[model samples]
Target: MTTIKNSPRNLAVTVLERINRQGAYSNLELNQVLKRHQLTVADKHLLTTLVYGTLQHQLSLEYWLQQFTRRKLDPWVKQLLLITLYQYHYLERVPAFAATNEAIEIAKWRGNAGIRKFVTGVLHAALKSGWPDFAAVSDPIQRISLTSSLPAWLVKQLAAEYDLATVAAIGQAINEPARLSIRVNRAKASLAQAQAQLAAEGVQTQPSHVAADGLIVQSGDLLGSQAFAQGIVTVQDESAMLAVESLAQVCDLSQATLVLDACSAPGGKTGQVAAALTKPASQVVALDIHDHKVKLIQKNMARLGLATRVSARQGDARQLAFLADGSLDAAVVDAPCSGLGLLRRKPEIRYQKTFRDSQRLHEIQLAILAAVAPKIKKGGIITYSTCTILKEENDQTVAAFLAAHPNFALEKTQTARALKADRAAKTLTILPSDYGSDGFFIATLKRVE
Candidate 1:
């Protein structure tokens, strides 16, 4: 596997095409391809930027390509050109000649001389003629959607939920790179100690509004360093950190207080909760259905130094077998849904997610809530959360769950977040806005029965 550092444009173009053709997640595919190719630090940064920028603004890039090429180009060729144009238009450091010349080289490999001419002509026109007047369009959704390259259905949903202006803001926000936030292992090192360690290595850090322990990384991939190896920090988003905080500060854990982390995979939340538990519990059943996911949770527990405190096991949220009536002191049902909310971080999601995915997920979410709500201990907290912004998955799903299960009650503790959050409801949503954050829906419920 080539590291991102020495990733060539031709290589990146091939990787990008593979992602589209194979229906692979862009981030996963990007890394897999980067590993085989050696790269310089500058090339690594450029490759990373080019890949993400192209994905982030794919729709917009394709918009111009369509104008330049009347013939329907192959998907691979189209993606290659878009990747080239991404650097040409958005990145000032990449010279225009370098971008176009590289595209022509890639085109020659992809097709005949005729295809090379097409690639040359399209990007060549882009450099000379410039972008279109997206603003002059009459339909606001069309304008913003084209400018941003978000799916039309998504734009309509956002526009209906938020005002046109706010939807436009979200579209713009999705184009920016989401900030990297790391959760410090206070158990392993204090925030000060961790920051100092990073500073020694030339990495920069800043506090975040998402969680008290959240740090916005200004430099270096902490994951690739000894700090992570030593269990000092873990990369997670700010919106995600809120899921653990919604537990309302568990001061006691030895009372055999059972906790269920539904949908706990890649184990970020499971580890976060264990870190905040503050006391060793008799059992914290960390569950995910996939066997590989169960292992990932275990790995995460090892990273955060919490493997001994939590049970990482495979169990579906919708069909938890051991969760009996009133059995859990707390249950975090991090339901699966159409992840429209994380579009900024995973730009390919915009293309993959569909309108009906939400409706289907809503059915699954409602089922999971119904089965799990009755299992919460009397007056114990049950937090339902998703890394998505759709109302169907957020308030609407919870409202439906409440209607189905009268035993559950809404707890308005969202307003009680650390000073940085200060959101309205204990049940609420978070949008990308200008913070370059992922959108999330979190609702804390109480088992009143």
Candidate 2:
């Protein structure tokens, strides 16, 4: 087998090219490339910064590139220019000359003499011309779209639903990198025990203000550490942890209970629900749509020492004929969504998602809720959640479900520490700026009949 090049710039370019040309996800593609190559900590940081920065500011970069290039360029050439422009404008520590020289060198390695000259000319032209004036854009939505590097459609949708200032804040927040957080496995260890163990291994951490069991990883290779290997901790966003915590708060998990995680994969929230149960007699059933995802849930449960408490099954959540009606004590429908709230972690989603996609997801979300509604026993709780802030997938979906199923009503009393609940509507909407977590929405409903 041939070796893969791992230089910071080369890796960034390779990752960007794949994402741009092949429609690969930025995070997944970057992780795969990082695992294949040996990179120092600093190089790893640089690679991550380059890849994410280039993607985050892609629209703005192209706007600037237009000022210099009279004609369209090759896909690889455009990506390389974006990477260099990202460093030039955003990363102050990187000298301008270094950024320009690196691009020319990479061009020489990957292109012909004509391409090399083209690359050099573009960089020199960009340096001489300076940045584009986004303020000149007349349309408010268009201005925000170009300045924030978000899609114009997303900007318009957000503007329609929120004030201009709030939309601007949302756009700014999503561009920043997500904070790293880990949930302490209460089953295997206490928060103190996990923190001390991580400290002993030279990992710095601070308690998360939002999640009761979360700790912000200040500095460390959390995944590479023994704490992770031994399952003392699992990387999870505080907002997601809050969703499970909300379900646990409203439901009686103190006795023998059956909780179904209808769309669990990678098992983060399922593990949270299982670990939160105070009674050993209670069990959590985790289901996913694919065999690979079911295996992933099983693997995660095993790692966290929860294999005995959480059972993994492969099946579509929209069809639950295998389960008996009114059999479960509680259920969580963390429905699949457009993932608008997770843009900080998954920047590529902004470009890929459309208004029509959200409409389709709203239907799927309601279908999964309807399928699981009958599985919940009388007075049992069903938690509806998504890693998206769009009302179409959150509030409107719940409203539609309640309209169709009159026996179930929103549980109004459930509350979480960092989540803001609309008591009148009985739903919690957690914006990214709200508590420094992903944009998430949760609602607890009761089968009152």
Candidate 3:
């Protein structure tokens, strides 16, 4: 009685195939497909797990597929086997025979007899032979790459930055699911009040170690709860909150009148800055190149009750000719990068991004910093942040910007004690393995003319 059109497994196969072939974003694509199908909550969870799990372990699955068959596979067929293999190894509750039969049925429904036979042979062979041993991978990098399901190039990149042990730890941490964390709107409610409110709505949360205003969701539907609905809290990673928290500490926000959240969209950090600016006249301009994104920032600001203190506009961060020189007190540059830090939440990034991509982003990040540097008044601060943990995007970008602009000096980031930010280094890099949060790099720069 299983149908290809609506079955969770079948839908997962379709979604994964699209992601692989067309380079579709996993989260957005999965959400769109889920809306098209009328699935129960359990089925929806299954489909989501299948899509992410398959993508998370894609490299290992493809490597195992090579052992069973050397021939090239049609994209869908390969994706079907990959998800099936993922279920076999990771989903302990799903009976192996049940997963195999379902995969075979899907293959039969989608392909001809030859393809169906090929899929059946591969799945059966995999279940019988079991997964290959990581110990057999003689090279340490290869061993970690295969075992962790990270790309070999990425593994090498991390290994080069840190030791093999650290790379292994990061690889292991990224595969684990990211916990849902939200930043409480301090202007509207305190941490205890937010927790009590969320608890009243059946959502339990614990205080985050990374940021004072951040909370980690322990259970229940936070996004659907009244606390989130009323804008008392908004979904943001704990590491992300660290950027604004550090900015507030390193810079004197009280005496400041104007602040710029360059590259702001959906305005999480913009709202955070708005919350910090207590003065009625103090304003934060949130800028993004896309009009829709600017609208999104405005929408978020209204929801968070920060609209009065924020100005959402459409503009390029690289060109800030609108602002006069030395007119701003402080600025926050949350520059865009390869997003390697979000691999846990969006596993597709590992495959989609390249080394060249990070290098190119470094130039763009440096440009944004340079464009905003001359605009800040003497003794003002510019807090630069990126979601990526790459040196090229973080440390190197700062170094390049500092080299060109001698007036700006890197200032040590002051954050929560739990963060244990290195006092000697002026920048803070939070790896995914550090606290099971998204990887982020934050650096504060002081402009002393």
Which candidate ranks first by TM-score, i.e. highest? 3
Top model by lDDT, which number?
3
Query: Once model 2 is optimally superposed onto the true structure by TM-score, how far is the C-alpha of residue 71 displaced, in angstroms?
Result: 1.7
Model 2 scores a C-alpha lDDT of 0.87
Could you give candidate 2's per-residue lDDT for residues 1-449 as a string of tens digits? 21225578878999988988888999899999999888888989999999998888889998898888868778888888889988889999999998888888888888889999999998998898888889899999989999888899888888887667788888888888789999999988999999999999989999998888999999978889999998899999988887778877878665537899999998999998888777767789999999999999999999998898998999999999988999999888899999999988888878888999999999999999999999999989998999998889988999999999999998763544534444455688878767778998889899999
Cα TM-score per model: 0.93, 0.95, 0.98
Per-residue lDDT of model 1, residues 286-365, tens digit only: 88889998988888888788888789887777786677878888878889988877888788888888879999999999
Clashes of each: 15, 0, 0
* RMSD, one per candidate, in order: 2.7, 2.1, 1.1
In order of TM-score, best first, we have 3, 2, 1
Off by over 4 Å in 3: none
lDDT by residue (323-434, candidate 3, tens digit) is: 9999899999999899998889999989998899999999999989989998999999999999998899999999999999999988888886536654467799999999
| Candidate 2 runs further than 4 Å off | 1-6, 278-280, 421-425
lDDT of 2 at 8: 87
